[model samples]
Target chain A: MTSLYWAVADGWTITRRDLTHWVRQPTPIILGLLFPIMLVLMFGFLFGGAIAVPGGGDYREFLLPGMFVMTVAFGVEGTMIAVTTDAARGVTDRFRSMPMAQSAVVVGRNGADMLDSVLVLAAMIGCGLAVGWRWHGGPGATLAAVGLLLLLRFALLWVGIYLGLVVGGPETVAAVQILVWPIGFLSNVFVAPETMPAWLGTVAAWNPLSATVSATRELFGNPGWGGQSWIAQHATVMAVLWPLAIIAVFFPLSVRAFRRMSR
Target chain B: MSVVAEGLHKCYRDKSALDGFDLTVAEGRVCGLLGPNGAGKTTAVRILATLLRPDGGRAEVAGFDVTRHPAEVRRRIGLVGQHAAVDEVLSGRQNLVMFGRLYHLSSARARARADELLTQFGLADTGDKAVKQYSGGMRRRLDLAASMILAPKVLFLDEPTTGLDPRARNEVWAATRALVADGTTVLLTTQYLDEADQLADDISVIDNGQVVGNGTPDQLKTKIGGDRIDLVLHDADDLAAAAATVSRVTGADTDIDRDDRRLSAPVRNRVAALVEASRALDDAGIAVEDIVLRRPTLDEVFLTLTSAGTGHGPRETGRE
Candidate 1:
C-alpha cells in the first residue's frame, strides 16, 4: 500500500514537471491550441462551402466534431516529440536511474497529456460554438461526445509514447510527425468516407478516428454520411473498443520499452 | 566498498562493450575510471549505477546487488550521465525541486532541498532563470546538484567534464571535491588523464573493456617508469650525440626527437642522471641548451599501459 502511494506520488511529481513546462513556455501550447482553431476557420469558412453534408445539415456542425477528433489525433505528434526529446536529452535516463517508481514516468506523461487534451478540447469546443456549430442532442449527449473525444486522445497518447520510445533521434521523430498527417487526413475526420472511392471509403470508415467522429456526430445530432454499413452503424461501440484495444497493446509495450532502454 | 563490480560483461549484438570488467571503490573516495572512448568506462559505470544489467557479472552499490535489488541501489546511488539531464524548460530550482519530489521528499522539504542545492552548486543567483537560458557549465552544475539532492552514498559521474572549457571543468571539479569532502563516494569516468590525476584518489585505467591499470596517480605514473631526464640541445645536429650521451649516462634507451632538438631517457636517480647527462653531453660537445629531470606524466603511463599487445604488462601494476 505504501509503495503504491509513493508510485502515485512519483507519477504526480512527473506530471507536475510537465505542467511546469506548460507554465514556463506557453508558446507551444498556444500554437497547439491555435493550429486546430486555424483548421476550423479554414475549413469552416473557406472550404465548408464547397463540401456538402450527405444528410443535408450545416457543414460547420458536421465539421466541428471531426475537428475535435483531429485535435485529439494530432496530439500524438506533440506527445511523441516530447517523449523523444526527453529520451534524447537523457531526462528519461535520469528518471530511470532515480528510485522513483518504474511506472511513474509514463503515468505522469499520460496524465499531463490527458490534462492538456482536456484544455484543448474545451478550447476547440468554444471555437466550434463561435462558428455557429451547436449540438441539438442536449447536455448529456454533448458530455458523452466530449468523453469519446478524450477517450480517443487517451488511447493515442499511449501510441505516441510507444513510438517515441521505439524510434530514435529527432530526424525519425520528424518523419513520424509527417506520417501522422496522412493518417489524420485519410480518416473520415475532414470529409465523409462516401465521397471517396468504394475501397478507400471502406478503409476510412474503419479507421479508429472515423469511429469516434461518426459516434460523436450522432451524439451531437449533427449530420454525417450515415452509411448503412455495420461498422458505421456501430460507431459508439467501436469508439470505446478502439481506444481500449489501443491501450491494451501500447501500454504494456511502452512500459516494456522504458524498462529495456540501453540494455 | 561503496561500489563493487566483478567480471561484468555486456555484449551489444556482435560487439562486446564490456568484457570481464571489475572495480571496487571504497567509501568516501573518488575512483576514476580513466579510458579513451569506447573503452567500456561508461558501460561499467552504468552497470554499477543499476541503470544497465550486465550479461554475466555481480555488482553491488551501497550494499545492494545492482541487478537483484536495483531499487535499493538506486535509493543509495545517484547518477549524472554524460549529457546534462535536467529539463530545459524549467528553471534550475524547479528542476531540483522536481527531482527532490520524485525522491519522495515532502513538498516543503523538496523546496528547501532545492534552495540548498541551488546555493551549494552556485546556481542560487540563476535559480529562477529557465535552464535554456543558462550556460553549458551552469546547466552541468545544475545536473550535478540534482544528483546530490539526496546526499547519495555513492555518486556515478560519467565523463562529467567531457566538453566543458578548462575553467568550467574546474568549477565541476571543485564541486566534486566538495562532495567528497562531505563524505560522498564518487565513481568518476573521464577520458582526461589530468582530470583523474586531479580528482581521483585511485584510478582504474580501462582499455577494450577491462582494467588495464589501476592505482594512485603517482603509482600509475611510476608503473611506466621513474623520473626521466630531458635535454633540449642548442643545435639540431647534436640530437644524435645527445641521445648517445644521455643513454650512456642513464644506461637506458633514449627517445630522440630531431624536430624539437630534444632527447629524453628514463633514469633511476634523478639528480645523478641529470648531472651525468649534462657532463657527458658537455664533454661530447653536444651544446646542450637545457636539461631537466621530471617524473613520468600520467599521459605516458596511459599510453604505455593501453598500447596494444602490451598484454598484462601494465595489469601487473594494478591491485591483484
Candidate 2:
C-alpha cells in the first residue's frame, strides 16, 4: 500500500492488462506452444530413425532442449510486435507524460510476456516427455536448465523492447521479423554447430542463444560437444554470462531511450 | 506556485519555436495562452512542464528552475499534453488508478481518486470500458483527469479543447472552472479563443514565437475599442463614389477594396454611420450588397497583431 508497493503493483497491473489481451485470443500463445509440439511429432516420428544423439540417448531427448531454446527465440518476436503495437498506437506516448517510472512500463509488460513463456516452456516440455525423451540428470540440474531458458527469455525480451523502441515506426517492424526467424534458426538449437560449415560453426557457437542451448543440453545429460571446446566445459559460465551481458548492455539502453523519448 | 520565465528562447532549424518568449503567472490563478497553431504557446508550456529544456533563457515553476531542477518542477506540476495521455488498452478507471499509483498513492487511495475522477467527468458509466472505446471527447476528459490526480500546484494543459465538439468543450471548461475554484493554478495553451475567453482569468496572446498581448478578457476587448462596420457595394465605380461620400461625411478613412467592398474605419456611432452610409450609397445609385456591425473578436486581434496588418507597436509594451 505504500509507495514502493505501488511501484510493484504498477508493473504487474500493466502486465495483467496484456495477459487479458492475450487471454482474449488464446490462439497465438496456444500456437507457440503447439508449433514446437508439431516439430517434436514430425522429427521424433519421421526423422528420429536417421538422427544421431551421439551415443547419448533418443533423438527426442536431444531435440527437447533445442526446441525450448527455439521457443525463446520465436517468442522474442511476439514481444517485439507488442512493443511496436504499443508505440504505433500512441500508448507509449501516453505513458511518457504520466508520473510513472518510465522503465517499469516495458519491464512490466516483459514480465507479463515471461509468464506466457513459462507456460509455453512447460507445455512443450510436457509433450516432449509424453513421447520418449528422458532427463538423465537429477531434477535439481533439470530445474537449473529451466532457469537458464527463462533468463534467456527475459534477456531477449529487453533486447526486443529496445529494438521496438529503436524502430519507432511500426510498418517496417513486421518486415524486420523475417530477419529474426533466420537468426533464431541458425543458432545451435536444432543441430550441433560442428555439423555446420566452419564459418557458420563459429557464428553458431558465439550466438547468445547457443550458449543457453549448449548449456541446457549438458545439464539435461542428453548430448553436447562434451568438453571439445571451452564452451562445452564452461556451458554454465556462458549460460549465466550471456544473459547478464545482454541485461547489462540492453537494460540501460532501453531506459535511456525511454527517458529521451519524452525529452 | 507561480510560474515565471524570462528571456526564453527555443528554435527548430530554420524556424524559431520560441523567440525570447516570456510569461509570468502568479500563484492560484488561471492563465490562458491564446494563439494560432505554431505560435510557440505549446513550446512555452512544455518548458514549464519540464518536458523540454529551452535552448536559452530560464523558467521556474513553484520556485524550481525548469532546466536545473526539472525533477523538482515535475513533482510540483502536471501536464495534459495536446495528445491524450492515457493507455488505450486499459479501462478508463484503470487508467486513472494507474496514474494515481504512479504518483505513489496507495491502492485504496488510488482507486478512490479514480472513482471520483470518473464520476466528476461523467465517465462513471463507461469507467470499465477501454479508452479506445470512448469518444474523442471522453478520452480527452480522461486525459485531463490523469493530469489532475496529483492536485498539482501547477497544471499545464496544452491545447486542451482542440478537436472537441462544443458540448465536449463545455465539459472541459467546466472541469477547468472547478479546478481553479479548488485553488489549483492552471496554465493552458489553446487555439480556441472562446475557450480561453471563458476559462482563463488572465490571457496571454502569443504570435510567431512571441507574446503579442496579455490581459483579462474585458481589458483586451476594451483595448480593441468599439464595433466595426464593413459594407459591400454593387459596383467598383459606384463604390468609389460611395467611399468618397462616407469618408467626407464621417471623417473616417474609407477605401474601395477588392470585390467592390468599402471598409470604413472605426465609428463610435454604429446607427448614425449605418444610416448615413446607406443614404449616401443609395443617392449615388450604388446598391448596398450587405452591411454588418460587430465587436472586434479575438480572431481579429490575433490576425491584426500576427498578420502585420495593424502596424501597431508591441501589443504589451504601450498597454502596460
Candidate 3:
C-alpha cells in the first residue's frame, strides 16, 4: 500500500514539475494552443467553401469534430519531443538512478500531457463555437463525445512516449514528427473518406482517428458521410475498442522500452 | 571497503570498453580514476552505479552486489555524470526540492533541505533564478548539490570539473573536500592529473581498459624519478660544461637540451644536490641563469606508465 502511495506521490511531483514549466514559460503553451485556432480559421473559412459534406450541414460544424480529433492527435509529437529532450538531457537517467518508483516518470509525463490535452481540447472547442459549430445532442451525449476524444489522446500518449524512448535525442524526434502528419491526414479529419478513391477511402475510414471523429460526429448530431459500411454503422464500439487495444499494446511496450534504456 | 570490483569486463559491439578492470575504494576516502579518453573509466562507474550491467565479473558497492541487488546499491550511492543532470526550466531550489521529494522526503523536509543545500553550495543568492540563466559554474554547483541530497554512503563523480574555469574548479574542489570531511566515500574519474593530485587519497591510472598503475600521488610521481636539479645556462657555450658539472656532482645521467641551454639530472637529495651543483658551476665559471631542484609531476608518471608497455619496466618504481 505504501509503495502504491509513493508511486502516486512521485508521479504527482513530476507532474507538478512539468506544470511549473507551463507557468514559467507560457509562450510554448500559448503558441501550441493558438496553432489549432489558426487551423480552425483556415479550414473553417478559407478552405471550408471548397469542401462539401456528404449530408448537407454547416461545413464548420462537420469540420469541428474532425479538428477536435486532429488537435488531440497532434499532441503526439509534442509529447515525444518533450520525452526525447529529457532523455537526451540526462534527466531521465537522473530519475532512473534515484530510489523512486520506476513508473513515476511515465505516469507523470502522461498525467501532465493529459492535462494539456484537456486545455487544448477546450480551446479548440471554443474556436469551433466562434466559427458556428454546434452540437444538437443533449448534455450527456456531448460529455460522451468529449470523453471519447480524451480517450484517444490517452492512448496516443503511450505511442508518443514509446517512440520518444526508442528514437532518443532531438534530431530523431524531429524525424518522428513527420509520422504524425500521415497519421493525421490519412484519416477522416480533413475530408470525407468517400470523396477519395475507393481503396483510399477504405483506409481512411478504418483509421483510429476516423473512429473517434465519426463517433463524436454521430453524438454531436452533425452531418458526416452516410456510408453503408459496417464500420461506419458501429463507430462507437470501434471508438472505445480501438483506444483500449492501443493502450493494451503500447502501454506495456512503452514501459519495457523505458526499462531497456538502462541497458 | 565501500566498493570492490574484480576482473570486470564489458564490450560494446566490436569495441572493448572494459577489459579486466578492477578497483577497491575504502570508506571515507576519495579514490581517483585517472585516464585518457576511451580508457574505460566511465564504463566502470556505470557498472557500479547500477546503470549498466557488466558482461563478466563481479562488483559490490555499499555492501550489495551491483548486479543482484541494484536497488540496494542505488539506495546507498549517488552519481553525478559528466553533464549536469538538472532541469534548465526549474529554479535551483525547485530542482533540489523536486529531487528531495522523489527521494521520498516530506514536503516540509524537502523545502528545508533545498534551502540548506542552496546555502551550502553558495546558491542561496540565485536559488530563485531559472536554471537556464545560471552560469555554467553555478549550474554544476547545483548539480553537485542535487546529488548530495540523500547523503549516501558512496558517491560517484565522473569528470566533475572537466570544463570549469579554474576558480569554479576550486569551488567544486572545496565542496568535494567538505563532503569527504563528512565521511562520504568518493570515486572520481578525471583526465586532469593535477586534479587527482589535489583531491585523491589514492589514484588508479587506467589506460586501454585496465589499471596500468595505482598508488598514492607521491608514489606515482616517484615512479618516474626522484627530485631533479635543473640548470639553465646564460650562454649556449656553457651547456656541455654545466651538464658535465651536474653529472660529476650528482653522479647521475644528465639530460641536456642544446637549443634551450638547459641541463637536468636526477638527484638523491634535493638541497644537497642544489648546493653541490651551485658550487660546481661557480668553480667552472659557468654563468647560471637559473637552478632549482624539482620533483617529477604526475603528468610524467602518467605518460611513462601509459606509453611503457605492460608498465612493468625497471622505470616503473611503484606497484601495489
After superposition, the stretches of candidate 1 with alpha carbons farther than 4 Å from their true spots are: B235-241, B308-320
Once model 3 is optimally superposed onto the true structure by TM-score, how far is the C-alpha of residue B225 displaced, in angstroms?
2.5
Candidate 3 lDDT, tens digit per residue, B1-320?
99999999999887999999989999988999999899999999989988888999999999999999987888888888888889999999999999999988889999999999999999999999999999878988899899889899999999999889998899889888988899999999999999999999999999988999888999887776777777889999888778788888888767777777878777887888889899889988989999988887787678777753332222333332
Candidate 2 DockQ, CA atoms: 0.34
Score candidate 3 by DockQ: 0.68
lDDT of 1: 0.88
User: RMSD of each candidate?
Assistant: 2.7, 4.3, 3.5
Error of 1 at B238 (Å): 4.5
Best by DockQ: 1
Off by over 4 Å in 2: A1-59, A78-103, A106-110, A194-196, A224-235, B11-16, B68-72, B165-167, B221-226, B234-265, B268-272, B307-320
Candidate 1 vs candidate 3, DockQ winner: 1
* C-alpha local distance difference test of each model: 0.88, 0.77, 0.88
Candidate 1 residues A1-263, lDDT tens each? 38889888888888888888888899999999999999999999999999998878899988999999999988998899889999888899899899898888888998899999999999999999999998889899989999999999999999999999999678887887788788878888888888999999899999999999999999999988899899999999999999999999998998898878858
Error of 1 at B213 (Å): 0.7
Worst 10 contiguous positions by lDDT, candidate 1 chain A: A168-177
Candidate 3 residues lying further than 4 Å off, grouped into runs, are B229-291, B307-320
TM-score, every prediction: 0.95, 0.83, 0.90
